[model samples]
Target: MTDLNQTALQKGADRALEKIEIDTLVVGAGQAGVAMSEHLTKLGVPHLVLERNRIAEAWRTGRWDSLVANGPAWHDRFPGLEFEGLDPDAFASKEQVAAYFEAYAKQFNAPIRTGVEVKKVVRNAEGPGFTIETSEGVIQANRVVAATGPFQRPVIPPIAPKDDSITQIHSAQYFNPQQLPEGAVLVVGAGSSGVQIADELQRAGKNVYLSVGAHDRPPRAYRNRDFCWWLGVLGLWDAEAAQPGKEHVTIAVSGARGGHTVDFRGLAHQGVTLVGLTKAFNDGVVTFQADLAENIARGDENYLSLLDAADAYIARNGLDLPEEPEARATYPNPDCVTNPILELDLAKAGITSIIWATGYSVDYSWLKVNAFDERGKPKHQRGVSGEPGVYFLGLPWLSRRGSTFIWGVWHDAKHIADHIATQRKYLAYRDASQRSAKD
Candidate 1:
């Protein structure tokens, strides 16, 4: 029996060496991968998308049951599919998003290989091709588009230095409020996830301490001067810092850096005390760096400044004013007010649970390809990388609205698929030339 098991393992390892032939191989099947496949199929391109798990795994396994998209329903749909439901404003649940992704794959007949975990992706030194090693099999393609997404890994500060008594968990592992420790809880990271988690814990009757970071605050309503409109108008969604122009800006100024878009006002009303940025956690007490209100205000100002810069760029470039496609009425100086902030120590507040809502990290160490920028972010232009035939999708700010939301991925996918088609032709020509030379 032991020999049989060993034989099977060896066979699987050998199969990993057999490089299957393909035109293009995408390493992911989440929103970005599905969108890429849809675009490629629409353009009649031959490609394969590799997913280690079922489609839309994040929506299936990561999110909480009570969670709904922060953005409107219209903003949730991907390419070739419209969000279906009675309420257009109603946010879709995680299950709904997953179902839609599954349907998208079936509807378009996207060539996807599920349960195929990509082990490594490396550029072929001999030619303008690349090799991808996966658990199911190996594949060599003329082009590779990594749609693995930014949230490839859960990130916890290496040294949180928190007391052993304080239970700590990343937001990825958190399911619901019931899982929280008894007594008060301190939710760190004020991004969308952090604020949302804090809101839930407080509503569940648990005393909650929210560590507020610098973050953008947008109105919940759709048909108004919301953040998305400003995103469109300012071209923040499409502007790239790598682009050689004054329109480009670093991510720090963008305020779109981390995914923190929860309704702070609602959370505050629920009695979730917003504290300043957490400096350290030890001896059952959380130390803060500055005033919570000051940090939040600074974050809001950064977001507003980015918007202003974007608006200026539009005027300078002679771009037409953005039309609010679904906006019903403008909320000029709306009644919505800023969520007031408070600074309090966790130990004094008697907080028990500690949830880190501090966003995610992307690790491309497995890729082993020379395609990243100084910050390890993939160097790509609308999904096409500097390395010929290499591409990336679902990257933040790849194009207008392409990075932050699912609805925006199509813009980058369409362009990337078009680029893939050209590469396919190039590969075909090259192969023919090689055969003729041999003959």
Candidate 2:
């Protein structure tokens, strides 16, 4: 490992700006970046990982202090390390997770430059590679990996708009319950965050209202099957294309919709009131329609039935035999928390404090690169962008249900690293051939 002093780092960055060569340049040092960096190093690929802030800054800085991950630590553990010594089923604090990531970077000696922001990426016309314009300096590399995850930007719903009288804040900005106004609160979007926030506010003795629309509900116990078990037995999220063809139906099905559904039944047991989808909030009053809950409940039923059918098919095919798969815990159905919701007859109820948990939006506007589809998201085939030498990781449905998970990044990283290696080999072969022709 090189002793990266400030002056030395600056000089190297400056030289890199002058068309210096590199095997790979990775952006973002979060889970994806760190995992990819370690894998690339193991493969003996010369590379550098760039981060806009300190390592795992988002986890360390953005998330609230007391907030714990909804998913258990087992499922969220990063590759090459297991979360132990604490409660196994316990959710990790943001600090704990951040420390783990930093330790991982140190273990692998990942070359990460903090406080360096990559502003733009320009592909070379002659086909050798691309140049990344960064705040530190220009960097030239044969390949670039955009490891920025899905939560790049917060998505605020248009219905809430932005007004002076009522306060608006994304779940990202929310810290303590004191941030909300001293009145009845309305939290929109019924995924994990919305439900959790509503629960938190209710516990704090604040009169709270939750507006939930279409959401997939899971039970806290399995009646006969666990979806995670089914996923593993069916090899639903295994190595395969993320397209919608015959070999990839499972990946398409579990795409990122939003936060996970919470134990709503538990919330109801706690006496928190829920509402339907919020249609409008104006003139110091919130307006909602009646049919929102009916529609949401219908969607929930259909999704559960689909899972049940898949489980049955798996059993019929002798898929869940003891010797055929690794023994694991069964998936639990979400506790239905819908009963506690107040009907969205907003005209009759008074509400305050709007928390927009509607969802997150993908923002690539700053990149200034032409690599997205009609949906304003970067388009990639197995992490390979349509343009040469540009790649992406941590996309919602990039490869499978596990694509965004910490464990899932390992497989995706290996595949992408292999692809980059192949490209490097081809370039070497082509250069050799061109020289022979000239000679």
Candidate 3:
């Protein structure tokens, strides 16, 4: 830790030992936590933000060195902060994203304490508050906001065969192709990260095999504009009805020059060997489902559906917009979708590295409250927890489809801040009333 981090940790330890009472405690000082703290500060709600590492630690270290935001800098801006020095159309690099969050915290003076790892959060039996046990010490807060983002711990499958000869790493741990040993690489999961990593490896002169799964391949640019622009114009982000039970999908694009679309056909044209989803790995052999063509068809259908929806929105609104000349030509070629490789011998294929791009899941084990479901997902509606005084932020589709993004956090944060302020006022009023009755 740097001197700054050390000082912050010392201050947090001192505060913990004192058992300082804060109106609200926001956990995880990433974009979500910072946004929440900013709103609370504006509301004049006494609150503290606790972070396990430095501000925006995930964006600082979780992503690859070459990783950049899939969305444009213009659309990724948080409330009261926009990309000023950089081109709005350009994608932000990971370093730039982290720096932006750090700047946002400083701009608003968010009360964030770094290096304070929250070990447990349980209800205070003695009072109407909660006890938060941290590495520094303990804190008592009337309310808590779990601002931890959706991506918590990487979800690697337990079915992966144990092999001593082959090296395995999750996509979160992968930096670039140079880090892998010299040999063919098998990347599991055809989501945004899997395809991007496979493409990078193939471009680096390594033989790459990509495992295909159910994924939506939205066009990076549509009708001479970014796809996100159309989504926003069509109000997809602010859709009143939430898609409640759908699995979270990754955005299929890169922050390259002019934004690069991550499509199956593009990867295939780049000489990436496509395979179906991994079934099992046993005794140096890997088994895959034989559904590559079907999966490609499904993705194509989704692409067409998105285009149709955009067309309908344009016609319905009587808006005249020029269509892209290359749109029709850019559609995936069915011939490019390869046959699925049902099985492959790892030794024979010379495949030494297996990258699991499987997604993530939250771990709320430390939360000793009945605010979570059977699967450990928080039981909340638009940041409000079933258990009073506890809340969640930065969840996908929490209020809208964009809830997990930087631009959408402000909506949820403001609502949560207002809710907390109301609770505080009620508590104060009730206490005064009780005292008056006694008098």
Best by lDDT: 3
The TM-score leader among the candidates is 3
Candidate 3 has its poorest 10 consecutive residues by lDDT at 1-10
Candidate 2 Cα misplacement greater than 4 A, ranges: 1-20, 220-230, 234-261, 299-350, 434-439
Pitting candidate 1 against candidate 3, the one with the higher lDDT is 3
Runs off by more than 4 Å, candidate 1: 1-19, 125-128, 222-266, 299-348, 430-439
lDDT agreement of model 1 with the native: 0.67
Clash count for each candidate, listed in order shown: 4, 11, 0
Candidate 2 weakest lDDT stretch, 10 residues: 248-257
Candidate 1: tens digits of C-alpha lDDT, residues 1-439: 0011222322343344354666777888999999888888787666777888988998888876677766556556764577776255456778888888898888866777678788988888786577787787667776788888878788787547547766788889999888766788877787667767676677788888777666555433222344555566655556555334322221221112122334444456557666667777555445676656565555556544644554566678776767333332222221112333333455666766678777777877768787889898788777778877778877666765446478777777888888877766776799799999999
**lDDT of each structure?**
0.67, 0.66, 0.81
Model 2 residue 241 distance off true place after TM-score fit, in angstroms: 8.8
Comparing candidate 1 with candidate 3, which one achieves the higher TM-score?
A: 3
lDDT of 3 by residue, 1-439 (tens): 0012223433554354345667688999998999998888887777788998999999989987788888899898785887758898888888999999999988866778888889999998886879889888877888889999889989889977798788899999999889999999999988778877888899899999898877777777776667788779878888855544345545556656458666687788778888887999889999988888887777777677777777787789887787754554553553435545799999999999999999888877778988988777789889899999999999888888888878898788999899998987887799899999999
Name the runs in model 3 displaced over 4 angstroms. Answer: 1-17, 240-245, 249-251, 318-320, 330-338
